[model samples]
Target: MSNKAGSFLRNLGQFSPLDPRSRTLRLYPLKFSRPKISHSNWNLRNLLLNDFDNGIRTSIRYLFQDPFILKSGDGSLQRKGISIATFLRVDRHHCPRRLSFDSKHSLVSAPPFDDGLKKVNVNPEVSGGAGLSKEINPPPISYRKLSQECNSLSDVLDIFSNAPTFPSSTYFSAMWTIAKRMSEDQKRFEKQLMFGHPAFSQLCDQMMKETRIMYYDHLLFSLYAMVKLGVPQNTLVVQTSLRMVQERINECDERCLSVLSILLKEMDKCKNVDVLKAGLRILVHQQVWKIESIFTLQTVMKCIGKDTSIALKKKLEMKALKELDRFSLLNSQHMFEALAAMNHRSVALLNECSKKVIDNIHGCPFKILVSILRSCRELQYYNLDLCKGIADYVATTFDIWNLKQILLFLISFENLRFRPTDLMDLLMKKVVEKPESLNMRNIIFILYVYSSLNHTDKCQHKEFLEVMSSALTGCLHHISSENLLKAMYSFCIMNYFPLAPLNQLLQKEIINKLLTSGDTEKNVSRLHILDVCLKLDKVAYQHAIDLQLPLPPPSLSLSHSKVAQVLSSLLGGEEYFARNVQLPNNYHIDFEIRMDANRSQAFLFSEADVTSTNLRRVAVLCVPRSLYCLDLSHPRGFLAMKMRHLDVMGFHVILVKNWLMEKLKMEDASMFLKTKIYSVEAHPTTDVNLHNTY
Candidate 1:
């Protein structure tokens, strides 16, 4: 070795074991400010002091300086570095460990050195640094060498094939990976890789190729992948996969089975009914074992009767009856299959099934049945025989949810094209027949439809409102707290639809319902009521704004006409709707209806009241002390909504209501006389007043 290198090695032997941290502390500032004491100079001093033991340092320097390394033919520095790294096996920390070699392996000789040169002595310093080591133990070895290595992919495959199954995690991961990989392959490759593989088939021999769990897991993966790949929803492979999964139900977990059940039902929700029908056919054949654990069979029975009763009483015009009959035939067979699937060999056992099974049968059968009902022309004709057939079927059955379904179908006939008179005729009959027997949900649904269509005609059967109200009150008692809230909210919203005219007794009943319902958690009930109040207030305010009526000031009174005070005691009124009101901003409302330009300085009624200008877009600004001036320039009406809610910021229903009331006052004779407004025709702008006309 050269003298410089030899000396460096000797110094390293003496200094390498000293703590690096201590060396760094002692050497840093002196090395930093003094050029002579820098790294190269430091190395030179060590080389001069210990010239005999630095073979590795000298060799690395030579490697970097070599002509081939400096000017590589391929010009790849990273390749060279990687080759060095592989050769060295240095960890990322740059600390080197023992090389893989055996004592018997032949060693290549080092390049010949000049005759005068002498090898550095490293043994003495190494022995000295170790204090009194008798001998160093051999370096640690890798554990992987203990196993026999497979030389080829064929051998690896054979190992798996001979085994009873791949490990569970490995098998599942393989299926997941293969399914994903299949999508990107050419069509031919996919067929060969997936369909031709015996491991993917359903029979026991194919299943024995892997565990049953693995096979089923792969089946799920395949089906899910098909959806993600945008295969035609009705493709044979997709359908086959679905059927295969359903066939393997006993092997699937309860949650998975539940999901499948839900999907089978929701298939109907797809726009293509044919897909739904096909899916239902496949699912109905499966024995959903978990059904007994999750559903209450008696509940379903109660619902079926209720729905049938509703469908029977629903008055259908000939046209609607015809439409209903048309819509039914296309769907009946599938509906019947779904309903029958819910029934098992034992009646007593039917009382409980997974909700998944019950709900599917409950909600879907009606849709299918509705389709069938539409196809029966005699029924569509609204013949007395058909109506009697429907009513008797409903009153006798026990399936309330199904009954709800049938009622909804009849209510469907309330569409504008169906004659309202015919619907009313059938509805009156039903209302009189089973007032007490109907469940609350069904009753509320009927009321919802009735209220929606009531309009001016509500005056004729005003007493029906009392019955409907009583029916809802009775229904509420039997339902869960969540349903009670939903039902009550639905009833209140339906009330807003111009049903029977508002009356004192009906108002009192509404208040009573609200109070009775509030007996649970006051805050919970209050929040629920507040939510309704905000919606109502928004609807009222929007209506007024759309009509351009002066709005009543935002206050507790308009929103909670029956229970604003009660709500405040629980929810702190304004704080509630101000933040949580669900009204859309773009909704149109009547905010500036009654302004008489001739009498008040606030608005100019003549040229400004053009049809093209939507005046409600204006923002109302409160100056100070109840002085409010609306900015007429803002875009009028509800702002378009980002989310669903009934309340809007900076707007309230009471103000809009008050504005409408004030607008009506302009029509009063006493106001005109007291204002001394005479010869209105003589006055162009001031003569026409809001309260003066409807």
Candidate 2:
């Protein structure tokens, strides 16, 4: 059985050396009359007839047309160890002296240089290599090796040409590797490399011009590399660069020039915004032009509209009217529009232009005024008249939201000297007149404005809450309960900032609104409530401890739900304050006044005696005090704990009654309190012993 198994395995190995599907068979050993390995060139016919077996000859003919190797001049077979030139030199010497060479490989062959002849001085000192020996002629360098280095350079350029759209770190890595190899002595090619060459300015310009929209990042990276490689920013190079870019700007693809023009202008000005804006004006041809050009006219008018200066206003009107006269343009609508919007020296220009255009029945001058207003709005150049112009446009268009945003913008602007109350009134009228159109964000914004402008000592101002709630409930149709709740929370927090009428009652009502409107989801309402709780808890604790404010009235306990919810969230969590915190011996405490009249309680635990057994606790009682005093004289009192009351009164109260043994239990605590005889306001040393109790 073992012999049979071995034979079966050996048979499987028999045909494994050659692929069965291949028609060609190997002709390993040829039978020839001359030594089979002799150095000679023989035809296929001769080899087939005299050397190969019949089956091998047929396979060899099918696989290849010419399968023989040439012999050396020494009549020895050329193999791996023979140098190529030696084989060539020796093989030529073996050919018959009389035979004419007709082979293609030998057609271009030249006689080898003579060793006896002294070389010419043309290349006697090759600059890069060591001096050559006079005794021996150096072998000609290989084309094959030079070709390989050329192939590597080609590969580097190919990689650069096909760079991925969004370059990854790996792409940069590959580039750095290729750059290292090609730029072995990189400084040598700094003048020739495309990225380092002045000629590359044209390439960049061509790319940006060819595409309608440039990937600004790619252009920036390329330009950054060029600048880093010491591309000089002189008059000639800069002009050349600008000329290339100007060609693109001429083609009207402004986006391509967006980053490019910014670079060129700011590069000279060293990142100055003013210089960049000036450069943009030049790039867009926003300068003096033939008075016939409407674009130039419009741009000049727009710039003048955006400027607030009274002096500059007169100057701009003079410039525009002069340009209008240059074309002898009689009362064109464009000229009339520009005249109407000018702040100085344009009333006559306006009357003339408006009369002609009106005679021609173009009464829609407000359209032009609105366009001017919109442009100046973003530039923040609006005044009362401009605001009125915008309001008039709003009245016509009924764009209440746009009007609100514009009003909000005006309200938020820092440098505006005009009164905004009138504008606010206008917006409120719009809101009241069209309730369905107003969204909650607008109403909130209005309220935010009210809060910003009206924070003063006047307590009679209606609570913003009622206004906000009414607007929210009545005007806003699509508001979700959850967002409404969160908005309320945010509003309450904002309210805390201004010293407004705040009380436990108001806070309780706010909390009720929050929880009632919030989603029950842990994320939705719970997190928001917790946020409010953390804020309020700090306020509550501070008021209780620092201001010595009384515990908030139990009637003002709408916040209880929120507090309970937060407590439930914090259960078993390390985030809560623990009773066992290793507190300092002389711990300092501070309190800050927050929302309404609430304050914050803060504990400052410093260096501690970790091994100490007794802990000190200070508890405060009462509301922010209208009266207070400090007592340093205390001989009889044990100075049990520092205590403060609502009147800012400090007391060195002696906790003379240690934990009553029965007080540890609830029933005992109740009985002890009921039995102890106490005064309404007892001094610290006034020891009232409970031994006289019934």
Candidate 3:
């Protein structure tokens, strides 16, 4: 060995383990003002000299300097090159553990001979007043490593605070991965900390000020995760991500649109949301044909919604039809609902869907049937084979369903104007078997449906329903006025009137509730109608004596519907045709025309004209879309009853439907109205043999 190296090796051995002065030796610890170690001077602290290796000698001091870490806000935690360095502490005692290391996998070397700390070390009194000026280059900020090691939100803050610029896409993904691994509770807590804690906000601002190299999916997913994590969209991070989405919308695809669909509403409330939504729509309009997934297409349709331009809706509808065959039996409900949200559906598409539904009817869920049924009405797409299959399935599966299932099935069917005779029989028995499952409203609906079906004394339905009606008398105190009036109306229509129920409903308090109801005009008209029904039964007339139901409501103003306006302009004027004319028996007529002798001249007729025999009255009622049966040509009992009532009241009935109004010009609408009125005069649709039936 060289003489100098040999001398240094011999000198290293001079500090022997058995030295007598080791018992009470003093030491100094290294300290720094901040993590800026490159130019920071190393401060010192005095500590006890006592440290031993399993009762061995303590002549030589050993220390470890952990890595000088610089964590990033949103950087990946899985980084390489973090090494701990073992070094020496001159003195220390009764202090918290401090660990630091270098990024280069090397230990902190001892002070060189030229340094002042080396000379004063031999005599501690001289170094006690001196500080070390050694320039320690701080470890490189390996944020990727910090992100990979992140176990908490605090770690994320460290990375964010130290990052020199907005994190790149990969770094953000790594950070988000750390968050994803957290438990629900941890995520919730961390989310709260991010938005509620100002320090975190300030720390994240620097790194999330702008999206750096984030693509469409990255931006959307980050925004989605942050919102789902409880970070409000108003935050700078979320806003920046949203802006990036607009800037990169052309780069987005179906996956991106699907994610955006979920955040559409939430993001709508954020700042500058209009530009974002419009931009998204433009992007969607451009990329819609590229979407093939049925669910994604459905989401895209709903995201576009009903209020968008006609061209967009038509594009979406065409796309939906192309993807219709892609739907499975369970997901068929989504397809139907998507089409229903729109004002139009292709008849051929609906027919094909109907066939497909019936073919797969055996596997369809009960709730799915309900949605399909309801959507059929909304789209006015009806097929008897499909209806029959659904009815048979529901009737066969009756025992497994709850009351809600049965009622919803019936409600949808009722709207579609299909009387599920088989299902109704099964449902009636189910209700009789479980009366507790049937609430007051259920009973009232049953009564109304049974009455409309003209089932009085023909079968046990009349008796069962009468019993059900009597059972609701006990609930009169809490029963809603709407329900009570409905029950009474059903009984009135069925030619059966219960004195006790009628008396109880007419009580001052009940009458007040009915009069003060939110829908007062309808209620008052109903009250007058009930009074008229009571006059048919001598005994029931007594209950109407002191009943101060309001006078029959005035004929309603003409609606803004193009059909109504066209009908009025062709007839004469709004004043010439009484709109929303109500009969004494509560039959609703959309427009009432009083015809003179020879049916040449027409006069306006009001509710008071119900007793007029001098004029041949014509009732123009708009059969609501719901009143149309699945056949789309026939009316259900709800509507059929009105027709029967109008026929019995001695008025020829005419029906109006506002279909294809968008494409119908004023002249076509006027002709449509003329044909509708004249066709009824020549031959009624609801009552083909009206004069013979009456």
Return the top candidate by lDDT: 3
Please write out the lDDT profile of model 1 over residues 1-694, one tens digit for every residue: 8666555555333221111222211111111011221233433235324422332223322121111122233633321221121011111111111111111111111113322212222322242223222322222211122112333222223333443222222322333334443445543354344433443322212221122223344455434544443433443334434444543434444334334444344332322333333332223223222123222211222122222332221211121223333333322233223233332122112122211222334333445434333433212222233333343444344335444555655564432112234445445555655677677666656654554443224544555555666665554445554444444444444343222222211244443554456554442433343343334444432221111112222422123222223222322332221222223322323222212323222233333443433332122111121111121111111111210122233322222223333333333423332223223443456545532441
Error of 3 at 167 (Å): 7.6
Better of 1 and 3 by lDDT: 3
TM-scores of the candidates are 0.25, 0.26, 0.58
Model 1 misplaced regions, further than 4 Å: 1-203, 206-405, 410-421, 452-460, 493-694
lDDT, candidate 2, 1-694, per-residue tens: 5643454444233222112222222222221111212336743335323422221212111110111122355644332232111000112223222111111101111124423222211121232222323322222222233334443333433433342111111222233334444554663363346344332333333322212122233334344333433444332223223333332233323333334433443354322223333334443443232234444454444443333455545555555567555433333555544443443435555544544443443234444544433434343443444444444444444443465455545443212323344454555555555555656776655554443333212332334444445556563357544444444444443333221222221344444543445444422333333343334333433321112122221211122222222222322222322222221222222211111111112122232222333322222111111111011112111011113221122211222132233224444333333232123233234334542431
The candidate with the higher lDDT, 2 or 3, is: 3
Q: Please provide, for model 3 over 1-694, each residue's C-alpha lDDT reduced to its tens digit, 9 standing for 90 to 100.
A: 8644454445344322222233222211211111122313333222212321111211223111111122244532222233332222221122121221122211122232323121112222222223323443323233457567777665665655553222233334445667778888887777666544434544333224223332346557656655555555444455556555554555556677787877775554533455556666676677678777778777766666566778887787788777766767645656677677655576766676777788888768776788788888888765778788898987887778777777788777766567677787776666666677667767877777665554333456665666676667767878877888888877766656777678777778888888887688878876776676565444534556365767675645556467668767876776557777666654567777776534555565443354556667777776545656545565654466557667767778877654544466787666665654554444334444432221
Arranged by lDDT with the best first, the candidates are 3, 2, 1
Clashes of 3: 23
Question: Per-prediction RMSD in angstroms?
Answer: 27.9, 30.9, 17.9
**Clashes in each model (backbone N, CA, C under 3 Å)?**
92, 10, 23
The TM-score, computed over Cα atoms with residue i paired to residue i, of candidate 2 is 0.26
Cα misplacement distance, residue 155 of candidate 1 (Å): 42
At residue 573, what lDDT does model 3 achieve?
70
